[model samples]
Target chain A: MIVAFLCQNCAQGAANTAGVQRMRYSDEIHIVRVPCAGRAGAREILHAFNNGAEAVAVIGCCFGACHFSDANLITLRRVKIVKKFLVEMGYSTDCVTMYTSRAAEGDTIVGDFEDILERKYDPETPPCPGGAK
Target chain B: MVRLSVVQLRGCERCAWDLLTLAKNSSVEFVSHPLIDGGSGSDNDADFVVITGYARKSDEARLRELLSRGKKLILYGTCPYTGGIFGLMNQKGADVVPVTEYLSPVASVLGCAPSPDELLSVIEGQSAQRQPLCSECERHFTDEEFDKIIRVPDWSNREKCFNNLGLACSGVLSARCAQRCIDFDTPCRGCVGMVDDPPGRMIGYFGSLAVNLQVDTVATDCATDRLGDRPDEITRSLVDVVGTFFRFHLASHFKFPGRNPSTGDELADIMVARPIEEAPQIAATIYGRYGISVALNLIEAYEAAAGIQVSDETRELRSELRAAQDGLLTALDQHDIEALEGVIDKIRTIGGNEVLSNVYFGGFKRPVKSAKNGFDTYCVGPLEIKAVHARSEDGCSRVSFSTDEQGVIREWSCELRSA
Candidate 1:
């Protein structure tokens, strides 16, 4: 049940709002904030798995928006690249995913938590159980 | 005053300036002795002999003769320390076919021309031996002088392996100190000897370059000046650290970074900040519809038309384009570029009458105007056709075409031709 958070600028701020509101989230979800979806890379995603993360999600600004200008597009590209590496490394490729949100998307944040936690996760990855190989 | 002597044999004189700066307030002397004449008449009584430049057997013999007189010598510059530019001759199979094989090691080079400071340091009994600064665990002994808590080693090695560490001499003990080599913008040549074998903390000391500027030019410049192939080793070491990033950075500045264009600039440009607004998606859509080559072409076209070289502020954007290009190409290659035939046909059908040529090809030519003049040119020969690659949004298929005439290379639904 390893969990990780990929926070978009808005989503992250919303998470802070959630914290202020005392909204509940699992303690297992380790948050790693990125400037934009575009900054994520395959090496980083794999490094997460190598370092004992079982599930990872990328949160980005709303579909049409980004922080550094065109970062959403960069994020999509990185997601695709990371997905390709995930498939190649023979991990449950779906273990890594991406979502978009706005700073005010508190409801969307709750929905994302439900979706990620309920999704079927494979634990048979080579680096799973323990990172020892 | 500190007495100094300068000699030039086979080396760039930059070390001479460095040595002079170090000895500016001290008394100094200079000499010029080609590897011939047994290098006689040099002052034997001086506090130190600052040996600069290249040295051969003749210089080695003369230096040995000088040392026989019980005088101190300093092998100045990288030339004496690691054979400098002359190390190129040591490349394997580099010997002339007609001559006997000859390859000189760094030890041999230094044995020939000792630096002035090194000579003085050794002669003044300052270099008697490296005090055991570490215990058997290869850790330095350190404790708070203020508190003075007794923290002594519990174990000791009955056998001394410092000899087994393969260190050249105590003089190289300084190599263990975070190589100041980068201080001079030069990568450590390991002339201080191999780091891994020597179990010590002072050695393998990771230190940042004094100057924040990248040291890409150091590899090439030092190699060219040292007249040796040692620079190749330095470059190899750099690659291990930064991968293709170093080559691209240097090449971006020098106009010739490396052998592969796709891997070089294509991967290097992605380190920039990508704005999360509508830009990335719009960029993706534009990129998805037009393909990576088209995007790069547009970026290149925009830069060329603007007649301004990419500024540092916009470099990250360029890097993003490159990173995208690399990702798309790698994805396409894995899936086979031509598999996108159906998508290409569908895109073509969808855009029947629209301008499919989202990509534009500006004629490539030598520079007619510099960036200062607001006129820049992409070097394109009259006969060379620009290659175009197109791929679908899902990255499943891609196809490439090129016309003998001028045009931009990228993915698109429509065809373009020179006016």
Candidate 2:
């Protein structure tokens, strides 16, 4: 299952807009609202993985468009650090990703969710033993 | 009246003289050689002990004796604080000791030789905060002027910011140098020392300037040229990133990966094969030293450049690298010189020896040649190594090496020299 932490102002708004538009995204994907994407710490992301999150995504405001000054940049770095740590722990690094979106880009959010699912379960490489899933 | 005693360990007595001159001009009582009133005072009597220079073994007894006096110790110069120019001795396996190893100083006045005014201020119990050099600089460039910057400018006589002229000016990374070098149309070499900032913020500040000026190519070229020749983009990037960012503060900064232990060869091995368990400690150290903002900026830059995302096999390879380094460190600790070869071979298999040599051996065009006699030789920059010799001195081993060019030979050793 894919777990996404979305910023309330931009990413969550986009998800809400997608819902109103009746866009089709993977039902396996679940969304959690966060005050800002920067609020998602590495420990929380690791916790999601520990609790059976197959893939993790953090969506925030587009670069330079963050409502809070450079909060999205913080989100980017935190995600990267978690991804690196996950890789070191013998897990797939690509299972964790960061995305940026505008409130109006509902279609992009749906597409990104689908893409993460496909990439996480690529048939060429077998699932890592004792992987997050 | 507070008594101050200045002791010269091994560096030039310029700072001591400066302090004496300032004391003479002030109401403060300073005691040193050639006393104005023809009177000498014992160091034990002084309220504060200002020590200058890299502490050698001969100075150990004296230092111990002085420390026994129970007076407040102030490491008064760069040498005592950070080993100063003598820090280069670390590359040669010298045992130059900073005052911090003995005991924590009340204050550290860091400069090649701190100005008498700064010394006086420290003596007066004033805290010195490093301010950004840009705040003191008068030069300002418009967008158009910044856009015109190239790696090598045609006009050297132009009066403008050296950075705008494509020079590798470290003003952005440094504390104020009063624009002394920049005014003379020379690039700032960060001689005064780095401001207390993470290297990442400095990189971001420079990178943003490059992007805004549309001179990323120029900036990259300047960095590449400064780092000498290396073929791989990642290697070149690593060198460029470190060279540009950690120019002055390499010895002091925690994030650079080679500051602690001062073992270049082993550090190269450890950096290339960073252990999974050590990542948190490394991250914490970087964050603790440079703060959150700077740490984040650096992480972004490093991830973007290095493509840290790895596959399962690569992860295993990194683990092997970690084991190899741990073995090497263990061997060094146990004095098992014979086991180092095997450990180095394992590291080479995991992370190519060529990459290791290029990164730590100063980017030599050829592989490092082990001497038939005993010394290991490698080219460092433009200089060709003729020979290296290791000798024992006062319970410590000192490595001495010579570089030759056009029949002229110059020698350098880890041995501390007299002022």
Candidate 3:
């Protein structure tokens, strides 16, 4: 399963908009609404992978939209650490990613999920638990 | 006679020689020295087994055999204890490991090369009181005086403290080891791994410092306020503080390492063999917790020491930062800014009230007072805290709180402007 950590304000709201608009995406993604993108950090990211998350996405508010002053930047930095660790320790870098978006853009979130899921069907890589539905 | 055996792992054999040359007692019997008498690895008869150098994948069998012997294992230097210089191979995938994970030792006599007398003291059981290396030759300075500190200093003045000179002396951050470097006028490189996480402490401390320092001194437009800004700097500075921090620029300002050389396919395929749980721990042991993958760039380093993940248990302040992080990620991640901010405020209240109580006004009952005119001061450990507020006829009111420890107004304190 893909564990999607969505910031409740922007990213989660974007996901909510997709839900409200009935925008369809892959069923593999399990949206976890966190207060902000930075809430899901190293431990949480690793924990998701350990619990069988084929991939994890941390989506935060767009730049300057974060009320706490650039917390998305903080999330971006942490995502770097976890991603570096995944690669250096011989884990797939494809398993993790980060993004910033607005609440009105439901289609963008759906598009991101589609792009992520299409990789499962990509000829370059082997198929895993997060299969192409 | 105490049977002493030496196991040379991966470092230069100076620590072993220091033990032998410094031993004046006739009561200790030398049973095996791999370089000298050359006994095999599985000797259980020795009362004291000294292991020097960091462990490598090739040395696993011998290390496990020696550890399995149930003898008193003494980690003889920085390499064995903190993975030493040879551990730099970790990012390269050579698989260097610290002896700390192998077994607890009778004593960890750590240093790049400890003075000859240290081994003698450990054998004699003449244990000295444990304290920070800074306390041995510390020179105190107030908050403002500290900012004037520079990287390099006049070599002539050996009496002065390196930290006071603004030299990033590892002594201040390290535990009381053999004061070998301190006495020799070369500041203490972190030969002994600190009891607390070194990289986190260094970045956090320097982050706070970078905040108070003039922006132009460190950088132009970029501001990296978080702790782990330079992954390469953290790894390089592990045991050699002087090379990375002091005598050079702040370690944060040091260049990040060139990208690690691992192919994405090679990474994905390897996980089939190594479990996910071991990945974090092994990486942590390698540098995740040790050197840490700090700031990706100079801008990120100053942007948010808050940007990096800090899990240091020793400091109460970091705990608050950790608490605030959840609310921040929530606050910053989404569009409902006001509600998420409320979550952050509530967390600060819980954290602040845990430490602060009874808001003792301290004899200031005026119409209102600015922070500078009527401030109350108190001490927490080595830090001195100052706070100010205005009170009504009933008592002190109007308290503002946030998790910014650096802000003139934070936690229990407020930037009480004139009312």
Candidate 4:
């Protein structure tokens, strides 16, 4: 399965650290680093889903530990609202998920992605053109 | 035929960008002039003057004088309506030299700018129209096959309440624009100025109604910054302050605790004394509470009513609320006082007050007493505050109260009016 991981700040830094250490991770997992998870608006998420990615996850800093103060909380609330919208648009809830991880939780992040990939997902629902998912 | 003249005021390329798009679709003739050129001295011949950006009071006066020569006008973009970002500096006190300095809400002030769509609509003799496309919806208003859509009132009209206008139509920058801004994490400065008919009256009239009705909360969206943080002078700082005030002009002028540009009304005193009124309605509609309740009830009914079907979740929430209400009524009828008390305690835990009180009411109060008359002043007790409001453009709040045997409210110390 094609999996995309949108990582913000701490998560992104951790990915870099993993990369520097030459830590082995699944080649299928693509990591995209962003300034803050909150900056990833609903449009961006929907855009990814519309494109080729079979599943997507937003990795923000752990609640209250965001580098930009309340940025993580804002993103969390926004993701909830966007999830509702996505559900109404007929996308499976399983396809989109939010993951909070500290910089040290690199192994956990990769492990969670592996577990999520094993779940059954419907391929029949056509993706929206230019939407994230 | 609406004769039109387009002037580039003080905005980014958005207004001009949209105007070019408009020029392609309509019969509008382009009256080209240098950006910030004001006018080419041939303004009197134009029928409709379309200003493309925010303008300072000086620019505003020039524009208004030019437009006033028997011609209609449209201000394009947030610059015209709320003066956009450029108006933010108005709060800092920068432009014109003044005798007595003050800040003012410019919603009603002449030469205010508006968005291109707004200007275009005005030029066409139709009221300013908001953006037709909802980003959430792929189709624009013109593309929608449906007819007879429910249209909301304009934001600038005084008749509509801020709450009743819902999340989209009322307040600043058009409801849709406001909601979009919020979605994008931006605050609306109210560039639209309550777009309904019969432009809204600022604090003076609304405040009078509030005092007369003894309403507690005005569902206040407007405020004045007398807090030392406010810039000392406004007239001189017109250039920077113009656009920001334009955005919040409606809230600023109509705000109960604000200053009027002309008469100098103090809105805070009205805010302070509101708690003193018996049965003061904290939340009121159109200066009273009925408007909000009616609007909310209507929305609920619309959602349930056959014509307007609400989401399953909303319907479920409504039914749940009804069931809860029924249960409470039955318990009350059965004399389940303990159960009722428990429920009340639960509500209190959630921060619901038994009866709202203006516990923290009073702010600073300034009287009209002159300095020549020594500051000594005395009055009776339990004074019945007759009316509290500000005069047009003067920006001072007027509190008229009847004295009990001795004047009570006036008993407080007075200071000399500075020249």
Q: Chain A only: list TM-scores of all candidates.
A: 0.77, 0.91, 0.88, 0.75
Alpha-carbon TM-score of each model against the true structure: 0.26, 0.41, 0.46, 0.30
Q: CAPRI verdict on model 3? A: incorrect
* Candidate 3 residue-wise lDDT at B334: 45
- Write one digit per residue (lDDT tens) for candidate 1, span B29-56: 3332322223454565455555565454
Task: Give the number of the best model, judged by TM-score.
Answer: 3
Q: The CA-based lDDT of model 2 is what?
A: 0.47
Ranking by lDDT, best first?
Answer: 2, 3, 4, 1
Please provide, for model 1 over A1-133, each residue's C-alpha lDDT reduced to its tens digit, 9 standing for 90 to 100: 4444445576687677677777787765777877655555444554566466666666666645567675554444344433433332233445666666556646555555555555423344333211222
> Cα lDDT of all candidates, in order?
0.34, 0.47, 0.46, 0.34
| lDDT string, candidate 4, A1-133, tens digits | 3444445566776676666767776665667777887666444554465455656666666656778876555454334433433332334445555666557645545544554454323355433222333
- Once fitted onto the true fold, the runs of candidate 2 whose alpha carbons sit more than 4 angstroms away are A1-133, B1-3, B7-42, B53-69, B78-108, B124-132, B135-138, B141-159, B163-179, B189-195, B212-240, B255-419
Q: What DockQ does each candidate score versus the true complex, computed on alpha carbons?
A: 0.01, 0.04, 0.07, 0.01
Superposition error at B71 for model 1 (Å): 32
